[model samples]
Target chain A: MRSFDGVYEGFRAPVSSQKRSLPDSHNPAVNMASVRYISKVVKALLTFDNLIWYSSVKYVLRRCEEMKSGGAKALLSFVRVLVNIGWYAYLIVAVVTIIGIPHLLFRDYLPADKPMPWMEHQPGYTITFSDAVSAEGLASFARYGLVLGLPNLLIMLFILHNLRRLLAAGIENPFTLENARRMRIIGFLLLAGVAAEIGVNLITARFVINNVHIPGATIRANPLPYRGGLFSALLMLIVSEVFKLGVLLQEEHDLTV
Target chain B: MTIAVHLDRLLVERKMSLTELSERVGITIANLSILKTGKARAIRFSTLEAICRELDCQPGDLLEYVEDGEQPS
Candidate 1:
């Protein structure tokens, strides 16, 4: 039973005796100081780690000092030029759509048997006021949607394309304060355009519908909403004013930045 | 329209090889070859500095003016 166990036990006693013979000076102050030092070291390490993590996140989200060395400003200016081009193009489309409205509305007033001067031939058939009003309402809806949606969509696409190109070029300039402000202004303009259209439709719907009725013919106004051309034009003016204000605000912000 | 670089001549006079010079100057052999053959559009001041430092010569020593119909100067 006491084969090699007694010898191993004898060797363990010397190591335990040595440990026990060490000075047992248990000072609470010294222990607390050691604990405080360890805690301070841990806190410093944690702070350094946090700093690195935050800087890395900022580098990914926004263009840090290093990645802004390329032609970021030039690219943004080019994007602005593209936006202006798109705005002018949409303006041209809106003007053309507006010019066509009169012709579309007055097609029935032209001589039926004889071809009108502008018409290539008689408009296939005579269109009543009720039919004309319904068609005008649909056309107005289409034009309003186009005028409100196309320019903004084009600008957004341009921004997205440039953003992708910048990312591909390894240049990170996203989330800049200027860019965020510009985006907010664009959103405001789009929302204002929509609101203006809704307001005009609400106010002028009954007037345009009532005025288009045939005398003594007892034709009911097409139950559909209608906004007069002049009122729509006025709304467009208001939207344009909002757009101009937004542009001015954005430019002022850019200058200040 | 054409600017000739006399790097090859300088390298030969200094008893240096293209590979050795490229390695000492920290530039690719291909770029050094292009510089020597006068096919490069532009060279940076830093690269020029490194090359001059490694070759123990000035930039003018590595570049020479050759008139259109005249011999190299």
Candidate 2:
């Protein structure tokens, strides 16, 4: 399997020599992040590789002014394509899951410690894939789907809305007031999705995972929790604020001319 | 909110059109319009000097600081 830094270093190796040794006043990680952020911004706005963004900001605004305003015609923009693919793939997976879960639950398999037919061979051994379905399995599946799947669906809907806005907007000025508003909405949704997960974990433990006994054993559907979404949501909110500021600046520049 | 540009008066006194002053000062008409309409955020010293040189007026004559009690004319 490929390791993480190997891919990153391949992209950065050529530029590494161009960067000087870090100074005591600056943190290397912070500087690298800023450089990457600014580079991405510049690349998106001007389609240039210039590292000195300060000098090009005015030039970029001028270029934006020169570009004619109208709705974008192409239906397959990067975000739109990616988001469409993701939603469709997720839908297929969800459908399969919906079918598979019920099928698994309804299986008429016996609860026994018998070896598989393959194990009857004197020189061979075999193992069964599952024990009888636990009493709490269906409830666990429902909670998992409710908590994880619902937020994912919401995120897809938000992205679709943003894609529509982008399609309706001019190519020159992709960032509009509507886009900024949607960005903020998406950011809040992301945070809410995290909160929903936490709530689901608690509700699952309390209600869904009732202490129950099967024929011979007890079942406790303990769930593993995650908080990475919280950090990502916070980052999105901050980026939304920056998007708002960019919209304001773009408006001011447009009116100035 | 109190600061005001007296460019219209200065231009009338100098008998010069805004375009003529803008050309002589080498500043864009849009920027000069921004200044004349009191929409400018700040005036650079070099630009102020250029405007003053072309219009034959002092900085005080071109700009005024109106107090809260008085309405700007």
Candidate 3:
């Protein structure tokens, strides 16, 4: 009886008083109530698998409420920092990619022992050669870095710059026309990136891949942009349109007296 | 845009300034100015009711349909 007190304590009156009224645990109603409460508790515990899950859910909801109140600002600021860091890292990689061009030009004049910093293998292709790979084949590796890398770097820089500005503006007012414009521009840039990727792949396959040969080698390459990029670009465009609608709604809300 | 807000005219007829109307309607002066200038995209029913109650005018009296090429007075 005293142990059952902990189970139904919150829902019912204190254990001593309730037991005094009950007279005996054999009372059918009392027995049923105790069984029902015990079953409910057991069910909840079983549903959660363990006590950790119950406490974890409670903690997460409390944290979520805290974030809803004011933690979102901290999260946004953290995201801004991460975006900037990513842009800086990408710039460094772009610089490395560009370095391959000069190395390709004056590779003999430079140290021959050093490995090429360029992207020698593209994403979609595998090549096998019986004889020695030609100089043209090696040069095409460096050319691959330039053709695809430069456009990608430029597009990413624009996208990141717009995103940085959009976040800064969004902190003040997320549904502003400027934010909508930034979203639209970002969407367009993503589409442009897809176009550039496909174009570069096609041009490379036509001009560079043709020259890149070995005596009895089979070169298999797909001159097509990845579907993921295309999907993302289209998704971004849809998001941009939704952001425009949000901006319009925000304007109407602001004007409402 | 063809539906012109006659809030300024209503305020003028009532001999009430925008600030006075804004205070009477319990709405912000800036929001009243937006409504007055006909720059508001849509008016909420609650806001329109508040404005109408203060101005002692019907919603129709405060808003009028103007022909596309005709200038609102």
Chain A of candidate 1 scores what in TM-score? Answer: 0.26
Off by over 4 Å in 2: A1-148, A163-180, A200-225, A243-257, B69-73
List candidate 3 segments past 4 Å from native.
Answer: A1-68, A109-132, A135-140, A143-147, A199-220, B1-15, B64-73
DockQ of 3: 0.50
* Candidate ordering by TM-score (highest first): 3, 2, 1
What C-alpha lDDT do the candidate models reach, one value each? 0.56, 0.63, 0.73
Residue B33 Cα positional deviation in candidate 3, in Å, after optimal superposition: 1.3
Candidate 3 lDDT score at position A217: 59
> Which pairs clash in the backbone of model 2?
none
TM-score, B chain, candidate 3? Answer: 0.90
Q: Lowest summed lDDT over 10 consecutive residues: which window, candidate 3 chain A?
A: A1-10
Docking class of 3: medium
The per-candidate count of clashes, in order, stands at 0, 0, 0
DockQ, all candidates in order? 0.01, 0.04, 0.50
Give the candidate order by descending lDDT. Answer: 3, 2, 1
